[model samples]
Target chain A: MSDDGPRGQVGKDSFEARLKSAREKQGLDPKASDPDKRLSAPSAMGVGMRVGVELVSAMVVAVAIGWALDRWLHTSPAFLVVFVLLGFGAGLANLWRVMGPGRMPGAK
Target chain B: MPQLDFGNPLLLAQVVWLGIIFLVLYLLLSRWALPQVGAVLAHRAETIAADLDVARRAKEEADAAVAELTRATREAHAGAQAEIAAAVAAAKAKTDAESADLNAKLDAQIAAAEERIAVARTSALGALEQVAVETAREVVGRLIGSSLDPALVPQAVAGVLAARAK
Candidate 1:
């Protein structure tokens, strides 16, 4: 029985070794094999990119609204400057909301 | 050659009124309208983000739960299989042991019956031998004189036994 135990252990060791080698050959880490990790990284990056897109779009809309108001009011730069600043402030506030402590990229 | 002068008080008054109106409108927009819109937009965005985050987290949790359930299912399947196998093996062992015991009991019964038959056969043979001897004695008594001696009977019986042996 003791002899059989060692033989069984050796078989298991070789099988594990072969499996490890195969995984290494496939450029995979045994410990990092979780598929969730792969998805999470990309998802976080995508969220960050989305937030950036939202911020940029908000800035562009704010500027456009400000320009249109300036034209309508016949106030060349007054509304433009003021609304642009307000738009920037609004954009920053949005950014803070998106990227603040509890509103992290991956946070719920 | 402008009809109205640049320094006209009416024009200046109009500019002042416009400024005042603009300031009031700006104040109204900033203090009331813009803030409300901003709050609503912010709330909407937050709600959307929160919903998205909830969806993402739920998906992740669901995935994890599915993985865990799968693992548990596999483990349960394995455990059930092992238990079933053990039950079957135990049943088989019990059946084998019972069969062996039954076979042994049957063999013992057969042996006992054979021994009884042998004893009965021996007893029957002995009875048959005694009857044959009695019948032979009766035949000899009838064939010979009724007054035949007991001492001659032994000699007659010995002679018959010797002839039979030859």
Candidate 2:
């Protein structure tokens, strides 16, 4: 009788596996195999909004600083051009931070 | 456009007021609303954890009960098998004993019957010899008008019967 224990355990394990798959198919247990993937993935709309905010915020701040510096130094449009390029580069960097392989920002 | 007019003095004041409103809203959300939501979330988490604990314990109990049931069933099966073996052995022993006793009784009866048959055969042979002697004596008396010697008749009958037996 004790010899049946392992066989029963094997049967139970298969039953549990099948049950888990059925639950997953029914949307009851959602992708329980990988918690990290679920946690690190954001909705597409959220991604789009964050990207827009990151790019526009950096650009707006840069443009404001450039405009103020031009007023202070009397060098019109030179700092604006430089800061515009820098802002674009910063935006790209922020995008990389959000969508990079590290997945830190997305996880947060 | 009135909005784009740099000469407007109220634009700066508008920006200052906007900043003040933003700060007030941020403060209110951070101090009151967010914390309340966090507390409720924590409570729900605690409840879920407690429920999960209870469910886990129930599952463990069910597993234990199943194991116990299996063990009992196995034990019972084994016991039944043992009992069946014992019963079969007992029946076989009883049948063997009965057959052996019947065989012994039959053998004794057969031996006794054989002895009775032997006795009957010997008595019949003795009666045949006596009848032969009397029959010869009567034939001799009728032929000769005198009874033959009975002793002589017995001797002659005995001789003939002995030769036939041989």
What TM-score against the true fold does each predicted structure earn?
0.43, 0.62
Cα deviation of B89, candidate 2, in Å: 3.0
Please provide, for model 1 over B79-121, each residue's C-alpha lDDT reduced to its tens digit, 9 standing for 90 to 100.
9999999999999999999999999999999999999998998
Task: Kindly report the docking quality category of candidate 2.
Answer: incorrect
The TM-score obtained by chain A of candidate 2 when compared with the true chain A: 0.60
For B1-166, candidate 2 gives per-residue lDDT tens digits of 9898868889888999999999999999999999999999888767766655565567668789997998899899999999999999999999999999999999999999999999998899999998888888888888887977668989999999999999
Cα error of candidate 1 at position B21, Å:
6.1
Off by over 4 Å in 1: A1-108, B1-36, B146-166
Interface RMSD of each: 15.7, 7.0
Which candidate's DockQ is highest?
A: 2
lDDT of each: 0.73, 0.83
Q: Per-residue CA lDDT of candidate 2, range A9-36, in tens?
A: 8977876676556545544456766555
